[model samples]
Target: MINQLRVKQRDEYYSLEVESGSNLLDVLRRENYFIETPCGGRGVCGKCRVTVNGQTALACQTVIDRDMLVELQNEEKTDILMTGISVQGVLDGTHLYVMAFDIGTTTIVGYLMNGISGELLTQVSSLNPQKAYGADVISRIQYAITTDAEELRKMICGTLLELLNEAAKSVKIKTDEIALVSIVGNTAMHHLLLGIDVKSLITPPYMPKVYEAVELAMQKLFSEHTEGVVRILPNIAGFVGADTVGCLVATRFDHLKKMTLLIDIGTNGEMVLGNWQRRIACSTAAGPAFEGANIQCGMRGQKGAIDHVEVQDGKLVFHVIGGGVAKGFCGSGLLDLVASLLQIGEIDGSGRLMNGKEYRLSDTDVYLTQKDVREVQLAKAAIRAGIELLTKKIGISISKIEKVYLAGAFGNYMNPKSACLIGMIPICLLDRIEGIGNAAGEGAKLCALSKTEYEYSKILASETEFLELASLTEFQDVFVDSLKFTEENDEYL
Candidate 1:
């Protein structure tokens, strides 16, 4: 029997026909909705939450048989930055405009700018279509190794093509008139976009098959586009792909004379520490805790996900993304909630949820379980310990760092005080921490705007050092020790 599925996404309605017994996730993925499926549709990862007939349920576990109004809990309206400064100089070197992209695992953003003035013409942001396969980089890598590798390449390239078409049409220009496209993302995103083998990436040592920056003909991916070259930024280490390199470029860390550190935390936490004299990079598999994965009642930064929380007048008050009912917790709220719990002496310094079994945000369904507290601890521990290890490798104390550049959208929205309270950032360097919003995208725009910036990144990548975090023996001990919420070991449990 045929069933009429009436889906409510944001403020719009989607009416569609489907066969009986069809899974909601399968139907959604087929329609390009890309609801998160970290377990690959095994009914795990409870990230795919939707509502059927006003009742909340997991999309993967729901079987559609009757016509019902389904509400999408994952949908949101994002005010993205479409334009930013790339380089100081610009010239009309080509006949067509330059298009840039920052391909993230969770979201993809595109920019269309003027060829002469390097001014932004238009921009757009959408969910990455590959989220249907998995959430984190490792899960996506596993999907490629076991399933069809070409599948991922096509899906991602298709998203890029959509961005390109949307951008070109917004300016009333032909696709072939686009002069060049510069792309930047993490290692898995970079490799998958180019259809490279990721076997070595998931194996021991975790080295990428292609580490250097690459330039490909635009016609190779989209034959209809112009014969311009598509530049993929260089990789600094195994998990630290061109996006990290772009972060370095955007911050101008290579030319600065003082000690600088750049940390871009996502499903994978990648950071770089150095200055003009020396540069070193590393990547930690911090898991997807920061992006609202692997925790009970966790979600991406969307409407109803508690984005901000604090202890106000000896009570916890939180602000939701859309200012409606609370559904789950996002990255920023998680950081703030944990830090508040710590300050209130509810959760101990050793990352234990004390004085109660779980922490309640409000009198609603929202809560922070003890296990959720543990997840955040592990995530922060990995990040904090990685910074310490990099500092030791460079023979410098954490206090010597002059500037700490926070890249990615999460970093931009996160509260600096909460990050410092949880020990994810050094207490001494709290004032030095600055959020550089979408630096990867900005870096790509810079490269496309000027040839000088592109060549500068290549030279910087060549001189940088890559330290394998997996190869370090002290990583385990330091991580366990860094789980404390404070530096005071005397008070920690």
Candidate 2:
């Protein structure tokens, strides 16, 4: 007979029947408990530690054998504000409705809000259209170099239009009701959207055609569709485009004193490090490993994706999102799987899949392969090296760093410990790290609502110093060194 576990919340008791071998993380998450397993259900982050009989044990790694009493710990409050405009109010009143878009490499998210109240009406997201070409910005840039530029622009624009229509449909608003639209994207994406040649971004001595703020009416660009004013966030440099500026605006970093680092992990891992004195920004081609691309059977963080994994008593246990059968892996799931495999000594520091291993997932026939480790290593190396190079270029030690804000869709799902374990982030900065979900989108929303934010974004564009990673010799060496996970004693790792 399966044992039952009871979870006591505020005036509510939920009972979950668990098999003898099931982990507490899977059972609790399945029962709709608000557990903070940011790395999905992986035990690596140590954030999901629950007191079992007054002793702490990782819920993801602990198996339920008998009836158990579980109490969830309260999570720390994040600093992000969740206020937004009402759709009906915006439609009925004279206030203009604004739409903000964060055109990420992996996912495209849109926000609809009242331009006056700054209240969020609705949020919508979908996979990026450029994903069909490749998951990373570099790949899309390469494709633009050889393929038709106009076609790429149309594809991205079409996706944006679809997202806008979807958001409007959900709130029962006309497309013309959207008075103002702001967009934030990487350099390559921004270039492609404007139908500009991006071949320069692909080669050495990368230079963007325009780096200042661009203001154009949506009717001018999308003449056949909507008639709202479209403002493309300005680019700071070749790599650091308007999205980084949007992040800066969203975080309000200019008002802070201590040195800060804003790291956005996606296909193009961009970082901005500085204080009130000055800020420096750069971009690294971190590939699509974190987005579940370039992996065997990898998929976006959608329904049916294996979003978490764990090892209990030398056995493999996993959970799929949407409570359905697993089809492939996502970024959070890949991190959890890698961390669990490492914790059990199934894989070494070099990320090699051990020979003669019997552990396998019940939902899929695929197992961790040696090549997957290499891909992950390459991705981690690019990110780590970018961080290191930026810190070094600014003449500051890692210890001097104050706060590390991780911004991105996957950033919200990452476990800081797993990220540190894999040498993707510095260990000393782990405690200071906080996840700010989709800061680019937040910045866009802020601009859509407030004129001050919109003006601030343009100021950020002019003030930030953009550093080209390709020009630095240290970046190349550090990138190569970081590829090898053999540096077990490195403090940053």
Candidate 3:
């Protein structure tokens, strides 16, 4: 049976003939409409909401049993963090133009630069299309194992070409005019971008197939897009890949004499401790809670999402993303809400809601449930435990660290006070904390600008030591201890 599906967004309408049982979410995505399915369409997150003939329904759960009129909820613009600390002193390169890419799990950002002058020409970003398969690396890896890996590779490669074309058009240049490309991402993203097998990434040792920097003919990844070479930065480990190396290069982590901690908190929490004398790196399975996955009312940072929460004059207040009614809570908002609740005695130290099973946001349908509290506990505990364990491995007290650098989007947008209050970051080091916006992207830009810096990234990757937290004997106990939402204590460190 065939059903006519009429889709309506604000002012535009799309009509398509579909099979009777076609999935609405898939249909929308096929037509190039934006909808986030962070849970891989499992219907657990409740984020994929749309209206079907005047009734609200979960897009993932809704099937086209009959001809229907579907109205998509207005999706607000997603604010992707793009700027980074400036990389000064560009050495002249041979190519007329070059492009650098930061292939993040959730987003991919590309920068077009003048190869000789290293002046930024244009920038473009797109949500990683593979997000339809899953939200995190593990979920996508499992999907690849069961399904086809080629599908993942094709999706990313197509997005890369699209970004390239968009950037070239923006700068009044042809795509073929670009001479060189540099890439950086976590291990899974690196492998997927290169179409390498990811089976090694999920095994017992959890190591990537390639740890050294690599190069490939651009034609191999994209057909006829450009006659150039693609240079990928080295991977440090399975979870920690070129993006972390990019962060290291951008921040000059290798040369810092002071004991500093660099943390990129996201779906996968990657951190490094120490400076010149000794450096140790580890990747914590922080999960996607920080990116708004798994929690009951969680969502990615987008329009209509409550990004910040506070108790103003004895009443709960929320700052929605686009000055609209609250639809859901993003990671930063979730953290702020939890911390505010803890401060007012609404939530106990063990991450329990005091008065009820859930705390409803005032004047909004959004609320945080008991299960949501546990999800925060699990996510924060992993990161806190990684921080403590990394310091233990380096044989240094947390107080001895002079500087703490928080990298990536979540790190920059999140309120530092709320982070400390929730115990995700140590309160003692709160005074030393700094937000370095998009350090990985900055590193990629540096790599594109200079051959010296690109080679230096390899040295940074080789010198840094990787600690396997799962293999550590004391990890379980420390992780359990880190689970509590207790006040910061000198003893915990």
Candidate 4:
């Protein structure tokens, strides 16, 4: 008889019989517990620290034995991004209410709009519950394959249901009254949400199982448990999912006369390079460093997390989200902090902090360590290198690209100047950078509100040429050079 493993998550406890040698993380996942596993249970990222009988251990590395009592670590409440969803045009009072969603790896945001008046009624943001499995797409994909894809699907569906209940309650409406929901996410989230076969996404070439817009009845996902239609915008390619396509739609990439680059940086760096005449896109494995994951003292945007940093009179000044004292560094704060550190010579060209193994940010219990710098180095390199490759592919000089539309909540919160100062983006594109907050969700709203816009998304996906970043010969060399943050590599552009 297999021994039963008892897990206490938050306030609830679970009793389950597990395979004698099964992984604890896998068992926790099976029971629908959302334990933070930024490293995808590979045991590399220590974010999945859990206590077994009051002894700290990585859930992924610990196997079920002798029915141990496991306590999940306290999770940092994710400060979700909710603004920048604008409803334009007019609403039809007769039309049913619509919901638009940007399904991100780290967070999920939804907009409840009045279909008739074209007014946004309510906006809700929540951490992607699937984050318990991993922090990146590849990890999530592996989780789906290793554990159960339906498990991943249920987490998202449950999260969506919770958000819907909240939104409907906020407006004294009914969840069943929602007429449509349009979703935009990267390829992995897209596939997992629909319970689509993700084996292709994990395999070579990473081609999507399907390449067209997907429309399914909510009843299909919920199996007669809900009403309304769920329309997933078409994806540009396997890695460049509908979120990229939606971002392009949000930024009006098709109508732009000048060469524009739309960058939506998250766990994956998806960017589009094009003008009204030509368009191309690519997905880079930028990792979750920019979102404040995979770092020893990093966290998502949340209360107690440092959100910004600056140097005042040769002293470090930092701002915390929901301010009191800093607990850890969020993406924006880390960027600004790194930029300031780089500018002040605290960190060298190769991203070595001058203060030694760890540099304390302030008198608060916050610090930036050597390992943290490496995380940022890898992340910034992937994104900057992708930007460089894209520009090169478009055959345009860095200065010639007229506008850089920064999409997603990270882009909105991050200081463009800091992003440039740290070389996350070329200094030349500094003046042109513009943050389009929750642009993917907004694009989904546009799709839900208009059939014409929905059709245009298909055209945009068809026109987009997905550039495989791994195929380029110059990519490796550029990535290596981009790892430097010092002014010594001034010719990085």
Q: lDDT score, residue 478, model 1?
A: 87
lDDT of 1 by residue, 347-388 (tens): 887778886778776677998889898989889888989899
TM-score, prediction 4: 0.91
Candidate 1 clashing pairs, residues 3+ apart or interchain: none
- Give the TM-score ranking, best first: 3, 1, 4, 2
lDDT of 2 at 301: 70
In Å, residue 20's CA in model 1 sits off its true spot by 7.6
User: Over the stretch 253-298, how does candidate 2's per-residue lDDT look in tens digits?
Assistant: 6776989988988877889999888888988877777776666656
- Compute the lDDT of residue 344 as modeled in candidate 4: 74
Against the true structure, candidate 3 reaches a TM-score of: 0.95
Global fold similarity of model 1 (TM-score)? 0.91
User: lDDT tens string, model 3, 279-362?
Assistant: 899999999998988888888899888899887776668799988788888999999999888877788899899998999987
- What root-mean-square deviation over C-alphas does model 1 reach? 2.9
**lDDT per model, in order?**
0.83, 0.74, 0.88, 0.83
Tell me the spans in candidate 3 whose CA falls farther than 4 Å from its real position: 489-493
